[model samples]
Target: MPRLPAPLTLPPGHDAAGATGPDPAAARDRYRALRRRRRTETATAWAFVAPSVAVIVGLAILPVIWSLLLSFQADDLVTPSRWVGLDNYRALRQDPHFSQAVGNTLKYTAMYVPLSMLLGLGLALALNRKVRFVGLYRTLFFVPFVISATAQGVLFSFILDPQFGAANSVLHHLGISQQGFLTDPGQALLVLVAISLWSGTGFCMVVYLAALQDVPASLIEAARLDGAGRRHLLRHVVLPTLAPVNVFLLVWQLIESLQVFDLVYVTTKGGPLGSTTVVVYFVWQQAFQNFTAGYGAASAYVLAVALFVIAAGARALRRRDAGSPEGAAR
Candidate 1:
């Protein structure tokens, strides 16, 4: 074996580190320069973000905090506001109308969420294939989502009108009796649910389609090679892959359904007999129409808390599911 070269030694006051290493004084200067650079970068980052942070604090956080304070007071948007802590909350439990609104909101959420998911998933699946006119079909479906809720309400009102409506005329042609869809209390809420599904499913379909497209073709081909049919592939591959998107849509649709107001406001106005009165609409009526700001704030705060709990629970379930054996396998 060849002999290695002897190690080099440095002169006094010089360290034997490497060519890349600077002298102590130079090293300290570099370190200070780096620290200054980092400080500048951080300051620049905060300067860029400050405007957005200020806007959010002013517009969103402040209002929520104010609303919380108002919830503990008695105010009608007029006269002197009186502090009546917990009274508004207590009144909520005993209010029959509030209870009814809660029931209606639950019913709407139950009907709307599943139907929207099913319809959106079905449409996404159908459109995911390499079919002609697919762009046109997607555009047509998404058009309804672009239209304002007020406009949709007006259009649906004409369609579901008992007398001289297109729907009734079509029913008449088929020799079927005319159904009072929006008029009858029994059918009104369901009719509203149907309208909402129609209006909103396009957005859900778009989201699902994007998620579906992100699925790896190689994985799907592998599954097919293993004798997997369409149902098997969907069950084992597609659904598992789309689990995160599904959770997101589930939570989003639930929240949206809970806050349903525009369609109900434009069409039913809390309806023929308060049958279609949802929590959000009820809050609107209390705060604006009935001039009970404090009680309305209390109601809104309760809803906010409920929504927070639901979101937290959903996120926990998602985390749990992600850590499961089946999720890992997928």
Candidate 2:
């Protein structure tokens, strides 16, 4: 073999200097250049997003902070606001209407969330099969969701009217007495719950359908080959795979149910005896109709805190589930 050339040696600060340092001035200059580039990139990014950031701060964040502050002050829109720390919250504890609204909201959420989930999941599972006209079925199911909430509320108001309405007309033919749905205090909230389910189930069904479609068929087949029944496959393979989606739907439905107002406003208007006075409706009544903006703000803050807690708890549970062995397996 030809003798290898002697290993090249370079002076300190030269290009090929291995064990020696570079020129301090050049290194400093390169470091400064990198810092300037990073600063410029950051400034450019912020400049690009400045409009959106400003809009959000002005419309969303500022309003939220203002509402929180307003909760401690008494304002009636026309008059100057006066500070009354915790008075609004304290009054809420003693206000029968407020208590009733809270109870009604909870009742609605409790009934609505589970029913919507079950009905939606059932529809999704059925439609997920290779049944005939699946596209048509999906479109029909989601049609209600596509309709605006105002339109649905108006339509249902007509359908559920005690007299001269399709629902009661069918009941009459069946020999059942015409029921006072929106008029009867006892039944108004339940009727609203039903209307909500009808209008909202389609969205939930679509979400579930998407999640179900994403479930791996191979895992399902493997489970079946290992003697797993349909229930076992669903419980073990499908549900675990769709855990994140389920949690998301649960939280979303809960929040939506809690903030229900449009249908109640259109149909019951808090009703014959405040039967359907959910918290949001109550807030509206106080802020606009009654001119007690501070009290309304306090009520809104309470609801906001409650929703935040619920969402945070659900997110934490989801995180824990994702880190578990079963979720990892999926």
Most lDDT-accurate candidate:
1
| Superposed Cα RMSD, model 1 | 4.9
The local lDDT score (0 to 100) that residue 278 gets in candidate 2 is 95
lDDT of 1 by residue, 12-120 (tens): 5555563444469878999999999999999999999999999999999999999999999999998989999999999999999999999999999999998998999
Off by over 4 Å in 2: 1-43
Task: List the global CA lDDT of all models.
Answer: 0.92, 0.91
Name every residue pair that clashes in candidate 1: none
Tens digit per residue, CA lDDT, model 2, 255-299:
999999888898889988999999999999999999999999999
lDDT of 1 at 85: 98
**Which 10-residue span in candidate 1 carries the lowest summed lDDT?**
13-22
Model 1 misplaced stretches (Cα beyond 4 Å): 1-47
Q: How many backbone clashes does candidate 1 have?
A: 0
- For TM-score, the strongest prediction is 2
After aligning candidate 1 to the native by TM-score, how far in Å is the CA of 10 from where it should be?
Answer: 14
